[model samples]
Target: MSKKPNIIVAEDEEYNFALIRIIFEKEGMNILWAKNGEEAIEILNKNETIDLILMDIKMPVMNGLDATRIIKKINNNIPVIALTAYALPEDRAICMDAGCDEFITKPINRADLIKTAYKWLDQ
Candidate 1:
């Protein structure tokens, strides 16, 4: 059997992370939580097999943009999806410039989240 995809979610809000955890876990993906961008980097450093990252833009310790930049330097192949409350065009552009493979805004929709995840995971 193929191994389940492992995903790291970099989010500072407990409630948001919990919601995402519920959604991804239900889909049989292995979920790892990072409360900030720094923690996300730590997780990446330790776990070499992470398949994707759901990065929150406004994280406290280090913002998603900075983290994404660092992460891209580490592994450009692993897809990083930006999760933000900002839906402005500039926000999207900023995320893309920071090296995010995809962008998803806050108050995440269940179907869209799953579809996006599958798109990146090639499932």
Candidate 2:
């Protein structure tokens, strides 16, 4: 792949994070993994070339909403997609309110993940 897209995945659950990683790995997309929101912030601050972010709403240090807000404040162009288990309407609202570019329901389909990434990566 030429010029692989960079993806930041902020998920605290080890198994869930791994599952997400596996999916991205299969796509041969360059990805950076973060266990929690704070770590996600650190990665962003470190200046990684993240084309997009797949954020989990609930995390240890800082929740995905707060992290997304902060990241967008710093740079709103980076597309952030909420990838969480919370299927509630309010859950999606919170993420969108926090400036998430888009969202996908949890138990993310591998094909959907790739499709979403491709869609936003182009933008």
Candidate 3:
């Protein structure tokens, strides 16, 4: 990509967010960290240039599923990927139902994270 892709990572855990920030920053992507879904929504409303979102399903306030639903309503064109620790089939189904374009189970594989982001941003 010629321009750096701006991405929102909605996660509550500090350690998780830090790890993600380090990895994505290394890829030269512009990363915005949101502690909860509410903050994510706020950021989304303010920034129209965000290319993609990596949403953590389990958050303290407004979980990723609900956030994804609201986000789709605001901007359906932007891809939202569910990044969560839940690996069950039902979890994936729930994320899909909530408008997540993709699902990544934690602990996230570095290659998968980069590959998925590239796929969505490139498309």
Candidate 4:
């Protein structure tokens, strides 16, 4: 059997992280939580097998954009999906510039989230 996809969720909000964790866990994927960009980077450094990252834009200690940049440097192949409450065009552009492979707005939809995750994971 194939191994479960490992995903890191870099979000400061406990509720948000928990919601995401519940959603992904139901889909049979492995989920890791990081409260900030620094922690996310540390997790990535320690766990090289991470397949994806769900990065929140406005995290404390280090923002998702900064984290995405550093993460790309560490391993450009792993996909990073930017998650933000802001839906502005500039926000999407900024995320793309920071090296995010995809973008998803806040108040996440279960179907959309699963579809995007599967797309990136090639499931």
TM-scores, one per candidate = 0.97, 0.92, 0.98, 0.97
* Ranking of models by TM-score: 3, 1, 4, 2
12-122 per-residue lDDT for model 4 (tens digits): 999998899999999899999999999999999999699989999899999999999999999999999999999999989999999999999989888988889989998
Model 1: what TM-score?
Answer: 0.97
- Weakest 10 consecutive residues of candidate 4 by summed lDDT: 114-123
Q: Give per-residue CA lDDT, model 1, range 8-104, as digits (tens).
A: 9999999999999999999999999999999999999999899999999998979999999999999999999999999999999999999999999
lDDT of 3 by residue, 1-123 (tens): 899999999999999999999999999999999999999999999997999999999998799999999999999999999998989999899999999999999997899999999999999
Q: List the residue pairs that clash in candidate 2.
A: none
In model 3, where do residues sit more than 4 Å from their true spots?
none
**How close to the true structure is residue 89 of candidate 1, measured as C-alpha lDDT?**
99
What's the lDDT for residue 42 in model 2? Answer: 90
Q: Using TM-score as the measure, which candidate wins?
A: 3
Candidate 3 structure lDDT: 0.95
Q: Judged by lDDT relative to the true structure, which candidate is superior, 2 or 4?
A: 4
Q: In terms of TM-score, which candidate is stronger, 3 or 4? A: 3
Candidate 2 residue-wise lDDT at 120: 93
lDDT sort, best first = 1, 3, 4, 2
Give the TM-score comparing model 3 with the true structure, all chains together.
Answer: 0.98
Q: Any residue pairs clashing in model 4, and if so which?
A: none
